[model samples]
Target: MSRYDPSAFPPFAVTVDLVVLTVREHALCALVVRRGEPPFQGYWALPGGFVRPDEGLAEAAARELAEETGLRAHTAHGQAAAGAHLEQLATYGHPQRDPRLRVVSVAHLALAPDLPTPRPGGDARSARWAPVGELLGRGGEDGVPLAFDHAAILADGVERARSKIEYSSLATAFCPAEFTVGELRRVYESVWGVVLDPRNFHRKVTGTPGFLVPSGGTTTRQGGRPAQLFRAGGATVLNPPMLRPEP
Candidate 1:
């Protein structure tokens, strides 16, 4: 036999945790599930499951999302059949994360412009979208009080989204396919938690090539003139990006 290191012990199983975020009622929300079994049983936690022996991490994440929330993988107009956007968030491999066994979890992040009614499945007692700020900032001294080290995973996902918004056109992922500049600004404000100057936001968005395309349409406003609507364009990165507020 070839001389090779065979004594290295492999860690326990790996899993995929998801932090599905959405702009609901003008606030940032994340999908959470109440655990049905022991080890933080009956408490709210991130939706996740063990990775299968035959699937990639991303595939497992998509599978868990569909199994738990009934959200399909892909649909037209960025609309999932269950109304959500699914993407990889990050991987958590802390050795002591799981109490029962050594488990590494790859977290995924999702975005949806419209909130869908969540239906719990698999090992979840209930599934719903909780506001990101509440989930991330309102927990007791333990910080999310989540099952496992999920609070850290959730924080990572949220920060990933916050940073992605500055460079990628991913903010549109939080808006409808066709939207007004005002609506787009609201997405930014909601995610960043800061108000943007409408005139400057409009100028920057309109001036950026392949950022927004005019739909040649207008909608009547409650008390003002009609506002023009535009659709998301091809650009994925902002050249001179809209910066996040300094904390």
Candidate 2:
């Protein structure tokens, strides 16, 4: 083999963008921030930042998440004040995606229960959660276009959440530790943008083994009548899977 030449390859930088999602007021919302600098300055975009040299991809993702929204990362095994389920989403490396440099973004998706209002951090001018419907509007008709290729990134993350819940128990990540069947159903509705038959949804979820365990309690939080509460069980993937309706 011949000697390798460092000059032969172009220099590039890596970044971590986050699609932090939650269900608020029966709507599926994503965290967004206003850019304070040029290259889409002042445009609303997904929360992200350049990866630091000392950190790995996951570490960089977690760091950026906290810096942008004050949210601490959590897996299925732990909890925090505003804990979220974090996982690698996808990578975007279009040659001209960034004008300033050759940049590759490794995006991650985070799902959490309804969160408190976010505080702007890092290079963000302001931060808040906006409904996915409003953000993913058509041709700038329903909503304003996001900065960079963030609109595509947000769409991918939204689809991932919508589809993951159909075959896995991951939807529970958007619910509190203890939640009612009605509350869980609403989570599905918000993510999928479709209404489900309440009785059918209740039966399907309860019948799925290891999907939920009764907390042996009841609440009238939603009003009308008391509903039994349950917590997410040990099952990660559903056996037969909860199929999505034809759209």
Candidate 3:
């Protein structure tokens, strides 16, 4: 083979844009930051930044996650990670996607419980969680258009979350350490945008082997008789997958 020429290929920068999602106030929300710099100044966008020369893609994503949301990335075992459930969602490389240069973004999806309020970082003017429907203009009212191709990225991430929870116990990432079946069902409802039958949901979840390990405790947090609390079990994949309801 002939010698490889570094000058033969055009230079392009790589960035990591995060679609950090969480269920807040009965709605599925995503973390967004207002741009403080040009190219999309003062406009809302997904939290992200260019990848550094020394870090890997996952590391870059985790660093950006912490810097923007103040949340740590955890190793997902049978359950969602300690702080969040993170995974590579997709890649966007449309030539005109970035105005500054030829750039490709490795998008990551992070699912976590209602995180504490975010602190802006890098070139972010402000950061907060916004309902996915409002951000994507699917909430009946006119919504805020995101900067760059972030709107598409956010949609993809949302769909990923919606689908994964059907066959995997990924939704637990949106719940506290110990949660009631009703709380877990609500997580499914919020992410899927549908109300599930409380009785049926409890039956199915409780019957699923290894899906949950009872914590031997109960609480009246939801108001009413005390509800049993449980933690995520050792089963990552649901045996009989919970199917989405027909529209």
Identify the candidate with maximal lDDT: 2
Residue runs of model 2 more than 4 Å from their true location after superposition:
74-83, 138-143
lDDT, candidate 2, at 85: 79
Candidate 1 versus truth, CA RMSD in Å, comes to 3.1
lDDT accuracy of residue 8 in candidate 2: 98
Cα lDDT tens digits, model 2, 175-194, are: 99899999999999999888
Off by over 4 Å in 1: 1-11, 75-85, 140-144, 221-224
TM-score (all chains, Cα) for each model:
0.89, 0.94, 0.94
lDDT of 1 by residue, 1-247 (tens): 8777656776589898888888888888888888899888877888889999998877787788888877656534434444456676667777888888888887878777866878999989888888888877865122547788877888888888899889878888887767889888988888888888899999999999999999998877424788898888999899988788764
Q: What C-alpha RMSD separates each model from the true structure? A: 3.1, 2.0, 2.2
User: Ranking under lDDT, best-scoring first?
Assistant: 2, 3, 1
Kindly provide the TM-score of model 3 when superposed on the true structure, using C-alpha atoms. Answer: 0.94
Model 1 lDDT-worst window of ten: 75-84
The worst-scoring run of ten residues by lDDT in candidate 2 lies at 74-83
Higher-ranked by lDDT: 2 or 3: 2
